[model samples]
Target: MLARASAATTALTDPGDRLAELCARIAGRIVFTTSFGIEDQAISHFIMSRDLGIEIVTLDTGRLFPSTYTVWDETEQKYGRRIRAATPEAAALSALVADIGINGFYHSKDARLACCHVRKVEPLARALGGAAAWITGLRADQSGERAAVALESWDEERALIKFAPLFDWTRAEVAAFCAAEGVPVNSLHAEGFLSIGCQPCTRAVAPGEPERAGRWWWEDQGSAECGLHVGPDGRLVRDQPE
Candidate 1:
């Protein structure tokens, strides 16, 4: 399936066409994860407007901003479809918080990654269960870690095909499309919040900063990843072994 999808859609210039073909090929077996960012809104618009059957879902990390939830409601209203919610395990979260007090992630990288593993990664694993294709709103220009992203590839860990339809699109291109299409956008973008994540871990980006600079700004790591989409080498995996 991975080889076939790559060969059939790699050279396609139109994102809509690629998505259409993907939806046709996978049909009810595909899932799309959205954070309601500008890029996510664009991809959601394409899927909804084109009547694609990819299931839309989001991880409710319990630390999101109110504006994020508002945009999510707006998206459902505009698209006339409910996005599924994935939550972390109750016992694990309670244990972690109890052991480290509410914000232990600030103390060390291990704690931070552990929080991400419980809140985002584990839930995402469940959300992608039995899915043949996993759709993401990742764009190459968003960060240096994702600079070499491909349109389609295999995800060995999840055992599914990963498709990033907007892999080649720029932030400007996404914003323009969203404005023209009237897609519901996160209100924080206007305030320079180029990347939105958990409330405590995110902030507005400054001038001349990368798009994801706002996320995990307190950390001094080389990457701002949350462990959900990164490989074993601590980089965004563009190509997975088939």
Candidate 2:
């Protein structure tokens, strides 16, 4: 399944064509997780505009910026489709805050990962449950850690096929596509917040920094990820198990 999907995805040049092919080839629910970033907005436009049956969802980490929510609302309004939100379990979130305080993620890497687990990763698991294919807007040039991302691969941990239709696209290409399509995006992108995540952990990047440098900026460059795409070894999971 992985090899055939990879071959099919690689054969396609356009992202929209790849997506349409995936929809035709895959049997069950295809889930697309968006964060309202430019890449995500572009993918959302493709899926919604084409009326593709892919289920669009988002991880509402509860700590998102106002601008993020504003863009979220605008995207829904523009597409006339409600992007399903997978939120953190209230009990787990309450316990986490009680144990480590509200902003404890700033203290240690372990603390931050724990916060991310409770907020983003866990909710994502619930969102991807029963999905045959999981789609993301990830691109190769977004960060060094994600440089080896594949267009399609098997997610062994989640037991689903992972597809990054825009895996080979560049930031400039994505921005240009969004501009031409008039896809609604977060307003913070113009203010240098190239990669917007949860409010407390994200900031605007400097002129020469990588696109994802604004996310988890205080952490080591190698550890900027929030565990959504990584394995237990802290590496991006692109395994194709035999």
Candidate 3:
């Protein structure tokens, strides 16, 4: 059933024709954000393979793991295209650190989410300010909330046509895709870091916990979503109402 569904949704099921067709249609205005995860790398490969004119970008978050940066550099070298960096809000790290010191987020959920907003959500909003469409590597297997996502949809939240090219893909399929494509993937994945974030907040996932369990592990896992998801108005909301 899953195979049939994947085949039905995979634009490249034919490998030679449909892939290019999809790429041509969505190229240029489309933008992809990479977090150096296996699923992300797979989409990056698929996009680059077609030489789609869509630009690639990522949020640096300023607190990413060394492994993530390495993958970023490797992907840039292999693709020969600039992956623009989106940085956090003005003096975000400095202000947050000054107010409560660097380790403040550990104290409370509100504090932690504030840090994510300043360091990731704000910068990401600026990065995607003018995009017509945004692509992500989100997969159903990653989280419970993402279980019903689709391959493509108009993200009323982001106010852009959001594309989850691998929404239905599983861990095995993502790994296999990377192996076949030889894409540059994060090394942390090999060390049990199924889902990684900033070094301070992230840890290696244990036996069968959800992949994203490592992110903001201290807070309610449900609150783990960063600021760039949705707002009351359903547009891509960057800042929390103050």
Off by over 4 Å in 3: 1-23, 26-28, 233-242
Q: Across residues 1-242, which tens digit of lDDT does each residue of candidate 3 receive?
A: 00111234454543223334545554346677877778778877877877876677888887899988999899889988778888876667789878767889899877887888888877777777777667777776788756666655555455666666676668988898788778888999989998777889888989989988888888887745675555655333322111
Stronger candidate by TM-score (1 vs 2): 2
Model 3 Cα displacement at 144 (Å)? Answer: 0.7
Q: Model-by-model lDDT, in order?
A: 0.87, 0.89, 0.71
- Best TM-score goes to which candidate? 2
Clashing pairs in 3: 157-235, 157-236
Please provide, for model 2 over 1-242, each residue's C-alpha lDDT reduced to its tens digit, 9 standing for 90 to 100.
43357466678989899999999888898999999889999999999999999999999999999999999999988889898999999999999999889999989888999999999999999999999899998888888888888888788889889889899999999999999988988999999999889999889988999988888777888757899999878899876533
For each candidate, give its TM-score against the true structure: 0.95, 0.97, 0.84
Instruction: Name the regions of candidate 1 deviating beyond 4 angstroms.
Output: 1-3, 6-8
Ranking by TM-score: 2, 1, 3
lDDT of 1 at 40: 88
* Tens digit of per-residue lDDT, candidate 1, span 1-242: 44457467778877788998887776447999999999889999999989887889999999999999999999999989999999999999999899777999989888999999999999999999999889999888988888888888777677788889999988998999999989999999999999999998999988999999998888984799998778777767677536
Most lDDT-accurate candidate: 2
TM-score, model 3 to reference: 0.84
Better of 1 and 2 by lDDT: 2
